[model samples]
Target: MGKWSNQINGRGNWSFTKYIYDNLYNFQWINRENNEIEDNLILTKSISLERVEQYIYFKDIFKGEYFSKLLEIPEALEELKIHMPEGYKTKEDIIDVINSRALNPNLKALDMSLPTHLNFVLISLNLPPHEGEVNDPMEYIVDALEKKYTKEENN
Candidate 1:
């Protein structure tokens, strides 16, 4: 999760993505000896995003219907990042600052089971704006992780 964040420069920074990753999947490395492992052991199994998308399932479907939505967020952020050279303030700001229609088609993950504040935010970020409610929700999906975990790097 943190190991494969989208931001290359921030490829490994301490952020909130881990909470979402842990909630979605109960995963740990297979260690045969001392049982200690490293973060490099965490990986996506492919180099291509499309190929990765094909494998983003637990059994029969993408982990969350909205997981795909979370996946699309980075591209949207890239657009927003350019428009607001400083930074994007909230999910609605991404729309308002861009002068997009105040309303937007929302995407939600209906069947996935993970429940956590981080999980909620990942989905909320894609939904049509409920302004004056939740604010920036991209901290979870964006590259907010570190190559290596540290007490100081806790998310």
Candidate 2:
């Protein structure tokens, strides 16, 4: 396991780290039966806290449609942005969670043909379901940022 896994060993009955470990594909791009990963899909093994943070905080610009819902959480709207899986979108044809902010990070990894479960990219940010905390992925982002800053200060 990598360094990030240390902080998130218990993730609501589903270890996201284990999921990545189990599902990591050797090839960068492969047509996995039901889906065709045209662009370089995220090499699951290469995933780290820094990379996941980068993808969430800076990589993909939020569309106005999605940002509209984000308006409900002004602070989160300012900080978090969704990670657009490579090849999932193109200038010509893009299919994003524009309909609703489901907060699922692994866009179609589970299977696009299947339904979306709104997993909300929690592991990367070092956030948690935290027993009784509001289970929304966006809700824990503040906690993740605070934790990162706290660690940085100590370091």
- Each prediction's TM-score versus the true structure: 0.16, 0.23
1-155, model 2: which lDDT tens digit per residue? Answer: 32121212332121122334565532222234423232332335556322222122211324555555655575653343334445443322223444335644444343342222223444444545344434433324556668878988999
User: What are the lDDT figures for the candidates, one per model?
Assistant: 0.35, 0.39
Q: Which candidate is the best by TM-score?
A: 2
Q: Give model 1's TM-score versus the native structure.
A: 0.16
Per-residue alpha-carbon lDDT of candidate 1 for residues 25-93, written as tens digits (9 for 90 to 100): 222332334332212222233422221111121222222343335436877556545646365645554
Stretches of model 2 off by over 4 angstroms after superposition: 1-120, 135-137
